[model samples]
Target chain A: MSLITPEFGLLFWQTLIFLLLLLLLAKFAWKPILGSLKEREDSIDNALKMAQQAKEEMQNLKAGNEKLLADARKERDQMLKEGQAMAAQFVEQAKTTASAEAGRITQQAREAIQQEKNAALAEVKNTAAQLSVDIAERLLRRELADPTAQQKLVDEYLKDVKLN
Target chain B: MKRLLTLLLCLCTFVGFAAEPAESGEKGGAFNPGEIILHHVADSHEWHWFSTDNGNFVTYLPIIAYQPGKGVAAFSSEKVAEGKTYGNFKLEDEKLVAIDGSKVYDFSITKNVAALAMSSLLLVFIFSSVAKSYRSRVGQAPSGLQSLLEPFIVFIRDEVGKKSIGPKYERYMPYLLTVFFFIWFNNLLGLTPGAANLSGNIAVTMALAVVTLLITLFSANKNYWGHIFAPPGVPWPLYIIMVPVELIGVLVKPFSLMIRLFANITAGHIIILSFISLIFIFRSAATGLISVPFGLFISLLELLVSILQAYIFTLLTAMYIGGAVEEHHHEEEHGHGEDFGTAEQRAGGSNVAHLNRPDVATH
Candidate 1:
């Protein structure tokens, strides 16, 4: 019977002790401990967030570098292709100019040969006419060697010219 | 095997020594196990460690009694040893009584009060040092005693506080932590041989329960009172019975909490004492074979019960606070349409599909 009953003295002490404990612990113990725990959690969370941000920034930087490298490669290829085309054009132009020079020289030589052949042909014709004139003059002189023949030839030529 | 036999022998030797005085002291040659067990479990002015034929090992506590007409008188309890009387007072069945037929209020430093003081001091020392460590070792891992108790503190915070009290749990943490460790430490202390049964006492448990009840009542929101006074969805005709029942339920929660812890710890002590009494009741050394092992087993069980009761008390306190301060949610109101779905709402969720089914089916 006594075991189940509550005593006033014990109750008073129990309540006093408990309330004091609650106050003391709340002020001195739990406040500091819980505050530190929350602070530690926040610090850790911040560290992880910063690490994630840094990783994203590194990825963006890498992507930008890759894009720049690709653009540089494309530009180099463009320059290389232009250089090759220019070299090809220079060779073609040089070949065309050499062919034109050769053609002009050959035409000039052919014109000079035609002119010499014409001059040579004219000289040969003039020499043949001169030789014929000299031969005729010698033949006339031999025929008039006889005077009476010559005079009768002159008189008959004269009577014929008068009768006409 | 040899060690174990020696330890058992030591236990038997202790039981034999402790039981003889109970058998021979007050009741002639006969042994009264009930009297012995009750004396051990009850509060007293003297701390009795053990008894032998030569003498008894005891510490007489201080007595402070206040008479209505007269002022307070303080003296050593040794002045009233073995049916003796002091100046105007006498010891009556380990209680202080006045000889002049007047009522005296005893505010002595009884066994339980002393034990409470010791345990509280110990708690303050341990926690203050731990608190200091937290200050000194900022941003570093807890070491030594700090490391050991940190897990339990976190468990009570996260598991008990956060889970029970929801978002506003921080406000009630100081009370929760203090009560948890106080109960736990005292429970463990009570398990020591010849120690005071401080936590098992009804007055101590009552004080704790009263604190919990007060906190719950003070922190209770409008929603909590609303649910109690006028339950949602209940017809007005049922309010006559429902209102009284709801009010009683509020009280019964704390009342049950008090009795549960008190009965558990007291029952553990009685069972252990009863087991030791078995050897004396039979008056044989062979009975020790059964009594010693059973007593040891119950003591170990009591160790577990100690922490378990502490956890339960704190958890229920947190739950009560949680219920009191919980904000009204529309989903919970919907669930209350079903008569007994509040518990189910708490268990599963506020949004049970079955709760919404009737409205949907009608539509």
Candidate 2:
């Protein structure tokens, strides 16, 4: 039947037209369209990958920053401890030097006072001896001066002196 | 949807009336639905839209015929109107025939040819511009026609191409996309009243199937040939039967592709025409109640089928290509090679099963 039959003319035209359409569309339509579609997809995928990488890099930088802060904090703590220790050491050294100087000054003053006291006591003893000696000499000289008067009396006492 | 239904209803009514008197007066004293349906479904030398008492509205195409000794004769089909003889040639049963018993080769540009050319141009224009927009838009969101057509292209690329054809899908994208759109567009175009049933024509579908077959056979790798000739784990003694079966499977795939599309489209047209023919057969105004609504329903269903058949064709094409180029893993060959062979057998077998099953009401 003509219903199922395929005429040569129609077949010829169908084949020719279909092939031409395929060739034309392949070169003109499908190539560029599919190419751009692929390019867009690749670019989108690349962008996502780059975004992931950037996020990771940001996290790394944050972690590095936190580590640096911690290190600085540790250094500050160590420095504060070292500074307190040095200040404590300086205070101890100053206290020891001040106490040592105070002891030396007190000992020197005590020695000076003792030497002054000895010197004054010796001078007082020497003056007192000289004064006693002058006073005794003066009293003896006065008694000798009274000896002439007594000589007359001695004539009376010659006999007693001779007897002595 | 309503609008389209109304338009379809008017067109179907117009077509039914046009063919009624012409068929009844020319053939018998009664209407012939078969003649009307076949006339509508088959290719013709002219594009007939409607007929009235005044004259018939048609476009006469160029008729080119060649005889072995007489050489080529070119003339407008209009010259052979009303069964008139033009030179030694005349129209006989919608064919250009030689008068003197000489063999004639008709190379006429029929209604289908013109429609094919028009659809081809339309395809070219739509896609070339979309391609241009892709160039211009570059990283921007698709707009208008680009956005509209992008999903279909991507669907064919992803669902039909990648999912069906695998990694080697890219190479077949052009052919796949072209065939899909070509079939889809023509199927929709054919649904409109009295339009040339270009997609429904056997010759057109045959050409498409042949191309798919050629591509499948040519692009097929060593693995495909191996499966066909040796069938992997099959006993060599069974090659006498298995080889022929495998080879028949190869030819049957494309043959079915051709017939499936041709039959489906042509059937749809026949069904709609038959529904419209009911009113005249009964010769009653009351038949309008039954005819119009049923015709409308079928036409709307046809809209869905047009795209569906196109998708099925392309999907199966992708599957065939995928099967052909598929590689056998070295591990599978040594360990579970028999199972692997049976798996391949199941795939090929299921496809044939799908083919043999009746299409039911969907077609």
C-alpha lDDT of all candidate models, in order:
0.82, 0.83
Residue pairs with colliding backbones in model 2 are: none
TM-score of each: 0.76, 0.74
Candidate 1 regions with alpha-carbon error over 4 angstroms: A70-164, B1-23, B26-28, B99-101, B332-363
Q: Per-residue lDDT for A26-114 in model 2, tens only? A: 99999999989988987999999999999999999999999999999999999999999999999999999999999999999999999
- Top-DockQ structure, candidate number: 2
Task: Report the error of model 1 at residue B118, Å.
Answer: 0.6
TM-score between candidate 2 and the true structure: 0.74
Q: Each candidate's chain A: what TM-score?
A: 0.62, 0.62
Error of 2 at B75 (Å): 1.5
Error of 2 at B144 (Å): 2.5
Model 2 CAPRI quality: medium
State residue B218's C-alpha deviation in candidate 1, in Å: 1.0
